[model samples]
Target: MIEINLDVVMLKRHISSKELAKRIGITQANLSILKNNKAKGIRFNTLEKICKELNCNPGDIIKRIS
Candidate 1:
């Protein structure tokens, strides 16, 4: 399974979803989908933008588990 780690990062950074959404130039609703791992697919462009804004790599956000 692919797990999304946004909650961990958010706790670590003490950043709110609203702040991240504003900083990333994405809507809160869209961010909620991503944060909740309800998104079926993500664009590479969006990933790049997120990584840039979050100052972290994809590995930091995604974890693979059996």
Candidate 2:
């Protein structure tokens, strides 16, 4: 299974969900879905934006569990 650690990274970066979403050009609800690991998938563009804003790599926010 795949898990999203978006909230953790956001906390580390001291970024609020609303701010991140606005900066990344997404809706707060959509960000919540990703943060809560309820998203079916994420676009590369969106992921890039997220990584840029959080100053991290994809591995920093995404995990795979066996």
Candidate 3:
């Protein structure tokens, strides 16, 4: 399954969902979906923006496990 590690990153960075959303130009609702692992999919552009804003690699926020 594909897992999201956003919670970990948020903790490490001390960033709230609202703050991240603002920085990444996304809504807090959408960030909540991603945070709870309820998002069906994500756009690459959005991901890039998040990575850039968060100063983290894609791997830092995602992991694929068997």
Per-prediction TM-score to the true structure, in the order listed: 0.85, 0.97, 0.92
- Predicted candidate 2 versus true structure: per-residue lDDT over 1-66, tens digit per residue: 999999999999999999999999999999999998889999999999999999999999999989
Candidate 2 wrong stretches, greater than 4 Å: none
Residues 1-66, candidate 1, lDDT per residue (tens digit)?
A: 887888787777788999888987889999899989898877888878777877789889888889
| Ranking 1 against 3 by lDDT, winner | 3
What TM-score does prediction 2 earn? 0.97
- Cα deviation of 12, candidate 1, in Å: 1.1
**Best candidate, lDDT-wise?**
2
Which tens-of-lDDT digit does each residue in 1-66 have in candidate 3? 988999898888888889899999989999999988899988999889888878899999988989
Point out where model 3 deviates above 4 Å.
none
Q: What is the C-alpha lDDT of each candidate?
A: 0.84, 0.96, 0.90
